[model samples]
Target: QDEVVGLAGELRSYLSLSLPEHMVPAAFVVLDALPLTPNGKVDRRALPAPADEAYARGVEEAPVGEIETLLAGLWSDLLGVERIGRRDSFFTLGGHSLLAVRLISRIRQELGIELTLAKLFAQPVLFDMAGVIAELVEKSGRQLLPAIEPVDRGGVLPLSFAQQRLWFLGQLDGMSASYHIPLALNLRGPLHRAALIRSLDTLWERHEGLRSVFVAQGGEPHVELLAAETGFGLVEHDLRGVDQAQTRLTELCREASDAPFDFARGPLVRGQLIRLGDEEHVLTLTQHHIISDGWSIEVFLRELRTLYGAFLRDGEDPLPALQIQYPDYAVWQREWISGERQALQARYWSSELADAPALLALPTDRSRPAQQSFAGAHVDIWLDPELSRQLKVLSLRYGTTLFMTILAAWASLLSRLSGQEDIVIGTPVANRARTEVEGLIGFFVNTLALRVDLSESQDLETLLAQVRSKVVSGQDHQDLPFEQVVEIVQPARRLDHTPLFQVMFSWENEDVVAATKLDGLSVTPLETNYEVAKFDLDLALREAGDEIIGVLVYSSALFDEST
Candidate 1:
């Protein structure tokens, strides 16, 4: 046992040098001999599972003190791990933004102390979080309060700032399906179709955002929540015995995604279930961008899985009552983004983007089209592990984040490609700074036009510093709506290009590996080709484990594959 433990410890140390904390396995098991099948292939089912206490570093010290013990237990439960050490990092054990929200809520409930997601992000390890919790407990005694149920302000609500922008765009081009957000999942195993439908119905009932529609009232746009009794437009197609199941599934997905929603009469959200086989199915969900954002998708998926399981198990809704709804948030935003606060935000953004350029002037393969065509294609690039690691190290050294580092690199690339020193890139912020709106599913994303001037030909380190400073300042004033900023700056709007910035950049820090497991079913995300582009060139970078995966989305009308 001692020798095995020693070898495991050595292996862990070696892995630590190259692997990220999360990629390194929490536990390692050693087998003396392989269990093979008749074909001499290793029988995975016959392999012994690691012991509950087994960890990559061999024996781990148990959680010490009352706070540590409590936190360890909660972390273990949330992460679905049998044991968690004091030093174990929450994210390293597969905790993400959504799971973090749940963990923090549970902590608040149990400890009677309110904590923010930022707190968990700052202190991710079990030992550190416990220390923070202990300090809070010492300073302020436990004060538990019951959650207030959301009052259904039954009536038409004003469109949110983001929603208003989308509405205006839809008015300009109602037939365009560029604003659609489509997600498909491939499921294998036994799927109860009736229970799944029930869960989806429950979702539409609980969240009004899914059933919302925009109607003009007195020459102004207003939002109306459709009746809860309204059905979620779900259609199923069986291609069980089809010669080309994969081809048929692709056609179905494209048709669903390309279909436009009537914003005036929604069911803005729709679903399609394509049966590839008796046990294989493809589930596709399509929603307009006006009603949903990236964060809302995570909330939707998490809730769907929970509600489906509950329905299948006991035919009861296991989810808690929502504290607030999307309408409430819209009401609050209207009231909040006015008067002194609104003026302050306006002043900050106007000053920050005072002398920014109107366009990036990226070289194109073809002449600019008379009217913008949202057709686009994506090129993916994967950064080597060594480069990814160095980027992290550089970010730490410069007191910046991986996001800032990648943005800097992107700006540099654009500078090289365009031969322009001044670069402006649009990036989306989650805009869920308030705790009250965290759980609500709505369009809360706001785009910020980040302008960086590289005219001085500064070194990469200096440019990173500049980027970090601008990012911090921008985040501080992010509450100001992007539409308001555009109005303030009064950028020349052209049908051929997006105003303020044509190129955009986004970073996905969270692990969004879409995988769900229910009773006898395994769900995974399906890659779909929906050719629609919002900007001239939008770059999305995802930090997965130790590697950085980048996707450059460019307008196909302007650039070809070679470019």
Candidate 2:
């Protein structure tokens, strides 16, 4: 995201060549790289895409009017750019939620506009933000106003294991690399070491999260600050002298897989430029899994391609200033999940699941095994298209998500297969509500115990309605932490019983739905390697670019894939 901003000055020239007219940015503000969690996802709330210096570059030619100059100055500081422009687009430059809050506060104080958070994200750049502010700024025509106030936003939920992993990984610390997607890049000429170094430098300067390293205060991983301008370097080598370059690449990759992300120096952050037998050049990015997630890899790939493309075009395409950061979102989350909010949400779950029990029961291969790590096979029997279509119709009629229809189907199947009335199943829930954190990626996801009871001879459609109603209630009460739910409800469990529910079922196929497409690239989908625990069955629906692949990793100790 930062790389997009650094190219702001030349945005109009490059992207305009191949993209639509509105695609270009009017101004750009470069900040430190993006922030990351322990598990290696971009901390959207930590985005420092301020607009305070939005007009620094264009200030020379800008109007001398007090309001206009004052506006430009604010843009400069907010954006962290040396100069600000009157025409800069907030989003085009990089402004996002964290900054939006400040912008709204400024509007209330300066122009008394009472701007909403929605309005700030909508109008991200200087001109648009000012225009919105101008409405109330001119109406009241108040005197000099204070710069926007920064909110203290963090510590939403004490870090979860997933979040901790991202934080540790972002600082270049933590776990070994579990996956690698090797791309052979054609640098377009004889291997030039300097050119490669320049490319790596471009990436380091542009991604704040990449530059960020972590430290542990009181035995917990915390954000350790860094100097943004302090750059990254690459050590070069000639593979032509070696018998085969690919062999060397594989070896280097192996080295990277074992290397942990270094919180002190940014582990797995370094790369080597090597020459193939004749003229080919290879640049490999090996970072630890703790700092980056699979999604983060995709984001990095797209941005790197754009950056490289820009360099090829001899023009920089910087985007607009951002509005906020991950920490800010974290702060917002704490406010949203407290007391009254929690109570309202809790009541929904309490009433919805009243006396409801499990939905899926399967005979165990081992009678309550002590412990197990199982990898089982899976086969999906897709309900006929006609049935799926009918399910959707029912969804619209009942006002529920498509998942409810499928979930009901699963309950029916389990009731018939197990010959039991009561069924128990687990469903992982994604707790993304606030608009700020939706696009800002993290493991803001959790698992919920969905107990669906298939009573004797109940109608299929009727059961589905019950399922839909409960889903709505669950969504409302999703704010209560899963741990808290366990504490409050205190669901009973046996020695080998899964904590809350068994035989998990989830339709995460919606995640792969299309959003935006890049200029020349197709998003290649890869099979996911997600680990599993001890269970009779577990299924996940992964929707890649254009395909939905059902992932079921079961306990081989419980049931064979052949079954």
Q: Pick the candidate with the highest lDDT.
A: 1
> Root-mean-square deviation of each candidate, in angstroms?
7.1, 16.2
Displacement of residue 348 (Cα, Å) in model 1 is 1.2
Per-model TM-score on C-alpha atoms: 0.76, 0.54
Q: Which portions of model 1 miss their true places by more than 4 Å?
A: 1-152, 243-245, 511-513
Q: Which residue runs does candidate 2 get wrong by more than 4 Å? A: 1-216, 219-221, 225-308, 346-361, 366-369, 372-400, 417-424, 491-498, 509-536, 542-549
State each model's CA lDDT, in order: 0.80, 0.52
Local accuracy of candidate 1 as per-residue lDDT tens digits, 1-563:
76775464467668868965545555678778999989999875687777653465223557899888888888878788776777677865667544665677678778888666566766777888998998899899787744434545666678889999999988889747899988888889989998898988889988888888999977798888888886665799999888887888899999889888988877789999999888999999998999999889888888888888888876789888877888777877877688997898889888878877877888899988988889999999799877997886676556456788888988988988889998989998888766566776789999888888787669877898788777766765677889999999888888888888999998875545365555668888898776688899998988776689878898999999789
Candidate 2, position 313, lDDT: 48
lDDT tens readout by residue for model 2, 1-563: 55454354455445547853234544455656768978899765566554643322334345346655666666566667555666555544434333444444454555545555445544545666667767766676665532322254343223434446455434442243332223323343443344335555666655544554556667676543355566566656677767766676666645533455555556336665555545555555555433344444555555555655555546664433335434444445556567786777566556544565532457656555664344445665444444554664565444344566667777778778888776656676555444333333234555566666788666866787677655544543555666556545556655444555667777652332133122343322222223334456777654343234565666766666666
Model 1 error, position 38 (Å)? 36
